[model samples]
Target: MAWIMLLVAGLFEVVWAYSMKQSAGFTRLLPTLVTIVGMVISFVLLSAAMRSIPLGTAYTIWTGIGAVGAFLVGVAVLGEQVNTMRVIAAVLIVSGLVLMKLSAE
Candidate 1:
């Protein structure tokens, strides 16, 4: 349950990030509201997950999920360039996350 909450929090992190972009320096009311709400929910869930999960591990996983999700969103929606190094880096991050999960068990 904690892990699930963490994952949801991480997913919301991506949404908030995208919302921030759409907010355009907070000039847009709707997007700005979305960003604020998303941020609050994301942090609340993250804090709940941290109750059971180690802070270091939870933080790393949360950040990794958000970074990867955001990167993928950028690539898929924004047509961002994906070079060999970027792909390799992403693969490495995934590998590390998998290793961490495996070791935790």
Candidate 2:
């Protein structure tokens, strides 16, 4: 399904983001390769999802999911700051994504 593909793409977006950080400006060989592979897979899935879903809607959802997921990962796994503003902003992003999905129906 298009939604499933979008979700997978979003998940890969997070993976690639984290892998890119680990790549250390591409100085690390394994992580850099992983990042490149993840990025390609992510974009491919995104394109596949777009075949069935409206471009605007799919892109917004994909980016929203990826951004929120990555932010949570950074906070929970990387011990990044989970400040009040950041939390509120993330909540807003998720709310907007949900609203978009609902409205698209």
TM-score per candidate, chains pooled: 0.93, 0.96
Per-prediction tally of clashes:
0, 0
Q: State the lDDT at 58 in candidate 2.
A: 90
Per-residue lDDT, model 2, residue 28, is: 100
| CA lDDT scores, all candidates in order | 0.89, 0.92
Q: lDDT of candidate 2 vs native?
A: 0.92
Report the C-alpha lDDT of model 1 over 1-105, residue by residue, as the tens digit: 999999999999999988888899999999999999999999999999999988877888888888888889889987889999998988898888777767666
What lDDT does model 1 reach?
0.89
**Model 2 residue 53 lDDT?**
86
Candidate 2's residue-wise lDDT over 69-92, tens digit each? Answer: 999899988899989999999999
Weakest lDDT window of 10 consecutive positions for candidate 1: 96-105
